[model samples]
Target: MVRLMRALREERRWIAAAGLLFLISAVLGYFNARSLDETLRAAGVWERLERAVSVIRADPTFLKAFTLIYWNNVKAVLTMMGLGIFLGVFPLMALVSNGTMLGVVLAKTAQKTGANPLWLLMTTILPHGILELPAAIVGAAYGMRLGMMAAWGVWGLVTGGHREVVRHWRRLLERIPIVVVGILLFLLAAAAVESILITIVAK
Candidate 1:
């Protein structure tokens, strides 16, 4: 945990930039969701979301929900981290897409249930989002770092600096495990908090 915090402090700029982009995308998605009649053609999205919410609300076993949600979050974080090596493409897309989905869900739910979107978000996402969102951005940032490192290596090889590039690559590989471990720990904490909060709130 100390190592993770140190790494986050070191890469604060990258994570902050990703978080800003996510917030912007979320705002756009919120506006897009507001005009559901014109913007969304598929009614299935609303139906599926409603069904999922209903299932969560009606389920008796909080442990089951907690486990499922925790696993899902773990998978998402791992996938994002693994995919970040592809020139950071997947990480960027994942962050933006996730933010957009969040906005859409919050807005749609509020509109349907006659609740305030801000209140719904506060009750549901804020608890876990405090950790999860930053952890996600940190994971993506590390992934982007890896992607950038690879790109630099490719460029170096093309420019006849192969030995130097190889050295740098070795260093990056050594550091990656630390970042991965930190992200996993963060996600675990986030999932636990989210599951507990959601279960309590739902009940």
Candidate 2:
């Protein structure tokens, strides 16, 4: 835990960058909610999301929902981290996409239910998002870091500084276990709250 914190501290800039991008994109999404909704629907993404939600809602015991939610989150975070190696494009895109999705969901929900946006956020998202969002940010942050390293590596190779590139790669690889562990812990807690507590509260 201590090591993870230290590693995260060391990469704070990347985290901040990822968070800022997400916030900005979310604002954009909220403002353009209608158009975005249309676009997502056209792409079939909205329908898929609805289907997934319906499946989860139909599960009586909540265990299926918990497993689904947890694994989905785990896969998403891991993919973001793993694909960040390609100049961090995947992580950056994921942040913007996810942030926009959140905004769109909030806007649409408010419009459909006539509920205050703040109330919706508190009741629906905050219960789990407090931890889930941070976990996602951490994953993206590390991904951005990896992307930076990859960029540096290209420069290093061009400049014949292979040794330095290798050293940095080694260090970054060493931190992966710590990062995964921290992310998993957060996701587990978040999933439990989302599947059980939030589900009950909503009912």
Best model per TM-score: 2
Superposed on all Cα atoms, the candidates' RMSDs to the truth, in angstroms, are: 3.1, 1.7
- Per-prediction backbone clash count: 0, 0
How displaced is residue 12 in candidate 2, in Å? 0.4
Question: Positional deviation of 108 in candidate 1, in angstroms?
Answer: 1.9
lDDT of 1 at 48: 59
Task: Give the Cα RMSD of candidate 2.
Answer: 1.7
Estimate the overall C-alpha local distance difference test score of candidate 2.
0.89
lDDT of each: 0.75, 0.89
Error of 1 at 85 (Å): 1.4
In model 2, the runs with Cα more than 4 Å from the true position are 198-203
TM-score for each of the candidates: 0.80, 0.93
